[model samples]
Target: MAIVARGQADRGPPRDRCGDPDLDDARDCRRDRRAVVLPRGVARRRQAVDHRRRVAGRRGADAARRAGDGEPAQGAHPDGRAVRRRERHLLHRDGGQPGHAADHRDRRHPRRDPRRAGHGHPGPARALVGRCRHRGPRGASRMTADDLVWILPLIPAVAALAMLAARGRATLVWLDLLASLGVLTLALVIAGEVPSRPIAAGPLRADSLAIPFLLLIGFLAVATSIYSNGWVRHEVAHGGMKASSLRYYHALVQAFIATMLVTVLADNLGILWTAMEGTTITSAVLVGFHGDRRGLEAAWKYIIVTTIGISFGLFGTILIYAAAAHAHGAISDAMSWSEINTIASRLDPGIVRIGFIFVMVGYGTKAGLAPMHMWLPDAHSQAPTPVSALLSGAS
Candidate 1:
């Protein structure tokens, strides 16, 4: 490096000519800065705008006058204020995108030329160039209907996990309330989104049939969570409900809600049956949580009957799977209800009819349908108030 005498200590950093009042004209500054320092794409757009002005000049004063009227109307918008008084308008409200933008794009792909009729995109507020670029806040993304399908069940499942770290009974109750409300919020969101467009996220999906049950689960969960706050405090005060067991009860309730959500959202027949079985296990534990002889007896009967019915359902599922596989070949998509329904006529009729009977018995038992309806009353009556409400609303 060459040594040189330093400038005066008070001298500030060098300013470009754009900052100088005497030398800077807004139009000239933009043109120079745009050509030399602007990115390649923006420079191309500027060149396109200049070409438009040159063509307008050739069209006589009337064309130029008409073009100027369409530009924005604020001093901050350089193209607006400077056009009539200082210089010709060189930009549009749409961040300087010319009327021939589609034409320009078509020139690059000779075979395709399509013009879009749309509302003019507003320009940036502070920056005098470029299109409006609105992005979601940092570290967040748009949550779609498809995302909510899986997220709904996960909210309560996560709360169940969170319960393990909780200390006080009040904290557990509040956690339950938040989780239930969260599930309700997701259900409402899914309800809004699914009606307009069906959402399918791999193993989980939402359709017309599932929405009502999901909403009921959500509503009942929220209502039960709120009601349990007072009811649980009373049980601890008057009844023999151990203060220590409240956390587990709340956790099991969330897990119960999770199973219900999983059952509703499952797209596969196998997953549905599995989720139903999961519901039985969670609810059985909750049914016996009271630690009384009657409660224990109710829980045992509930599990035995539901387990037997579900086993029939499982056999039915396997038979249906076999039918689907024989029709479509042994493939992974055989387990999906939608796929099975698409080829329903091709399945072995005798095996399908038998499987249907087994499945009706299996799921019907849990649903409290006749002949398998023996366990419903005792289990519901023995379970805690919140669980009873859940069983009633979900069933």
Candidate 2:
């Protein structure tokens, strides 16, 4: 009589289970079998899935605690400690075999079972998993259009500091050109994103209203910086301007650009007014960089006239703030454009009218409108042509 194995053929000499001698299943015939070895790629994928599952489990527990009122609310999954305890209980029941533990739970609860948590992820956790998957195999960092919006202003601000440090070096011109181009590219990127979607980060925000100004400023910055490079070299070659003066001129131009960017990006009217004044001060120095009598006269006039105008603008900003504070009882809430525009109808009508008129006149003076346009012509004509272009187009 011949003895036959459990899964062996009933009537055969000696056939391998899968007709392959290398396979573990072919080596022995067993009634029940499980795979113990996985391919390298399959093992890696399994590890990643396990990592995601662990992260999802922890996040689910955190969400439960945050959403819970007192006890673990009705249908929510158990927290980490409870899940661990349950896992330990199952481990003990199956004599430390995890596969047997899963089978035991399925047999015990055929309808609904907590042990089935391994089946799939929770809702919020699935969303997080989707984001992780989007990061791709290489695990590169991701950026959104909203991130570029806030980064736009920082480009010129950093450039200003770099230009100031590199004062006497001839590379200042190249630095200025590269910095201005970077700002322009970033601004264009932001402008494209802003029309369909407004991007905001804390106090700085960009929308349809700000798009025109940002594009205007960004273009002017690039154009003016390019023009300044050639103009500076020419002036230095001739006796018109000193080579040492180039440092002061380049530094001030960057500072002026940064201030204008801040002005356009400011979310609050008060901050806008302040940044406008900052542009005035920085550009005034650039206007008088030649240090001639006419340049000096122009810078002085620019300072006096704009200072007086901005004072009125400040007063107007204060009046509006006071009115908004009366309505909301919070200064921060009052200062934001979104908050103020929402409650504009409820604010005092008379105060709003007066404040707006003052703001208009004050900003109009800086804008180089009639009657208040006295300082513009002298500053533009006497300053370098590049500075003139900015004063006319951007400032």
Against the true structure, whose lDDT is highest?
Answer: 1
Question: Residue by residue across 252-350, what tens digits does model 1's lDDT show?
Answer: 999999999999999998799989999999999999998899999999999999899999999999999999999988579899887898999999999
TM-score of each: 0.66, 0.65
lDDT of each: 0.80, 0.75
Which regions of candidate 2 fall more than 4 Å away from where they truly are?
1-142, 167-170
Q: Itemize residue pairs with steric clashes in candidate 1.
A: none
Top candidate by TM-score: 1
lDDT by residue for model 2 over 1-395, one digit each (tens)? Answer: 32222333453333466654435544454323323555667667777999999999988877877677776432212332333335446645735454334444443442433334342231122222223222355766688777776678788778777877785646888888888898889888888888787888777889999888888887898888877777777888887888766766787888888888878888887778888899899988988888889999999999999888888888888888889989878877899888898898889988888898888778888888778889988988888888888887665
Worst 10 residues of 1 by lDDT: 116-125
